[model samples]
Target chain A: MTRRLPDPRPQVEIVAGRAHVVGQQCAACGLRTTLVVSACPGCRGELAPVRFGPDGTVWGSTVIRVPVAGRTPPYCLAYVDLDGGPRVLVHVKASTEPVAVGTRVRLRGDSGGDLVVELVR
Target chain B: MSHQAAVLGVGTSSFGKQPEVPLAQLAWSAVQEALSDSGVDARGIEAAYVGSVLGPFGSAQRALQGLGIGRIPVITVENACASGTTAFHEACWAVREGRYETVLVLGQEHMSSRITGAIPPDLGDPEGRSGLALPGVYAMAASRYMARYGLTLRQLAQVSVKNHGHALGNSRAQYSGDYTVEEVLASPLIADPLTLLQCCPISDGAAALVVGRAAARRDAVRVRSCALRSGRAWGYRSEHAWGFEIVRETAEAAYAEAGLGASEADLFEVHDSFTIGEILSIEGLGLAAEGEGGRLTESGHTALGGPQPVNPSGGLLSRGHPLGCTGVAQLAEVTWQLRGQAGARQVEGARIGVVETMGGGVAGLDGNACVVAVLERP
Candidate 1:
């Protein structure tokens, strides 16, 4: 007999050339979050997988100048609040200028399977 | 029978980059000092609780090997940065429940020899894998706070200035200097809006406390309350910033347990691993209104001689943060301040002191863990 192993990639999928992150929504309370959990953290209700956003608004951002996690220095990290719901931490395309809070952004793709976002021109 | 817990003695190894000192030796020094201060022999310690984040396995046993206290039950705690105080909290409960009359709580970390740059987030953490470093998290908070509350860069740098200045009188501090806002801002940037001076340095040290029944020592600083809480799931709809609610809720719980308000505390030793951390902590601790911590700090209201001083022992920024060691060190500082033994940097007439330490970096949550403790001079 043969057995199948679960995919190790993040729950992000690309549809119609746009990135969408697979999250969860509470069946009982309608709460959404990117954290994979068996029960809703808020109400202890059942949760179902839900896809969130190709677009979002930058809640906060920072330019990391120190090396970390096998990555070189000078990168941007941001908390983007997806349009449908759920806030996710992702890499923002670094620019000469700092990413401002509340900047309109959209999912560009994923970096090594991790979500990445960019400013919406 | 229930008993009241009190800190019989507290001690700390010098806070700095001591790469030569082994973790066991670092812990031994603090343990020895605490034992001497409390006038308690090694054989008298009925139980031991140790906290360390990056230390080797069985660190508690290894550190206590030479002291002949190995036979007692040794529990090790690892709650990221809150490890020390969490151990202290556990020890307090053990004493309170009559599990042990006297117990030792020790926290030690030797990061200088192992880590060279910014401490990486856990490999298993989604945010850590997404390139979100610790400084980046605090910097993002600073950005959001600045945009929302009109906090200036100068106001943010003032946190570093005040903390560094406070460290001047702290003999155990790792780094101290008379720094200006301009000087702080001029330091090499670690994360946007957060310079090198704004971040705590990589340090190696340990701190220990002796906890006993309140009636055992008449001069002991009473452990009025020690409240520990884990973060809740936070999403975009969350009312406050990432770390705000957890700290607030934990502080509220601690204050309620102690039967007093934040105003009653004369001093505070909060987790200021970054400059922005201090501002957020002050607001969360109810020392200032939301969005008002910057103004309160800029006005010198949180300085050493201020009405309600914060981090009179220089805080993690200057006293140095050894992850697990920080919370224990904060407790020691508060104990000394409450007993009027904190010379030069003493908060005069400090009858009560509050200590808050937060450990974070798990994805999709406010924080990993936070501890809020209230101590009183009796």
Candidate 2:
């Protein structure tokens, strides 16, 4: 009998085998943010959690050549502008392919509760 | 009449590596110079505000403790790279509100002692945990800006060439040499589209300024306005990268307070921590229209002798970015220019100038903090 481990990130939920990201919208000012907080960042109003799509567009990207801890060199980082939601920073899955602005992307999450983006041609 | 704050004197230590110097010693160097330059005794300073990014928790108290300036109120400011200017802003407020007759503002940083390359964002931040370093973040913005505006890489490299060329006249600059656009393009790449020549070096240095009532110093420069703002949270819509919105709003507020417009300023000293950073800043500050900053640089509109000269003191690109020191250093350069003391690189007959400095990176937010200050010759 294996004990079920609690998810590490509060903003991420595992439904069946798929992962979905969550955020909060202010009850007063309509301000939205990716982090889970009791009060809204804008108006300090009560917030309710809302789920966002696993799809977004690559607003911008960069190829980092410098060595980073626990990460491979030359990995891509992108600002993924989600559909009907706020932007998020995620690691691009492509190792060799170049990423550009406005490239459509599909968000994917790992068991570790980390999000990454896959470029859609 | 509202109490007014005037800049009595300004001082800056040579910016670059100084591994042998302690943080307090670096601060003292600038403080002593400022005291001498202002012809004001240390005993006259009623309070002190110190700014630093990586300095210890009690760094401000430690900086003023051993100096024998008595037990005056001392406070430390930590607002990322904007720490220096933020300290200056607080000092001005103290003088304006009549809480203190005279105040000392100091900024110091020792970047060369520990880390290298672009500074990392806070580990607890979502973006930082995603491994978004400063260079990578700027590169992403640069890529989007270039694509949106049809800017060429050659045009972008020209900014580095121009700033490095400007640095050749200043002895305090970190990296200074006349280089062509090709040389800039050929330099070792840090992030895609950004090369070694385009990034600010890790440096150690300090700067100091004295703010007092206008009647206290007849030769002082006037602090027309100083505006500071933190980033606003993202709403339902996604915004552009690089925090342009905050820059614009802060600049507008500063200009409104000063009763001036962007076109009225004869010179600008901005945070050019990266070549692309300057492009974004100038545009957001209204020095150039959107998508026109690169073109403005290429056309010589932002050159030393141009109509709207910018970063005549080499900026952070070549003058070195000692985080906390960069902001106050900009004001010092402006003060010199306004006083007609900037011998070689001065904007001819500069009477009005503006300084803009920004700092910190939090994901999903426009920016952490942005400061805009306007100054005029008294």
Encode model 2's per-residue lDDT on B273-336: one tens digit a residue: 8788888889888999988889999999898889988899889989899988889888888888
RMSD from true fold, candidate 1? 2.5
Index of the highest-DockQ prediction: 1
lDDT of 1 by residue, B155-194 (tens): 9999999999999999999999999999999999999989
**Residue pairs in clash, model 1:** none
lDDT of each residue in A1-121, candidate 2, tens digit only: 1124333232656566555678877789776668645798777999888876577887778887776654666878877777876677777886443488888887777424457767776
Q: List the residue pairs that clash in candidate 2.
A: none
Question: What fraction of correct interface contacts does each candidate retain?
Answer: 0.68, 0.54
Model 1 stretches astray by more than 4 angstroms: A1-9, A94-96
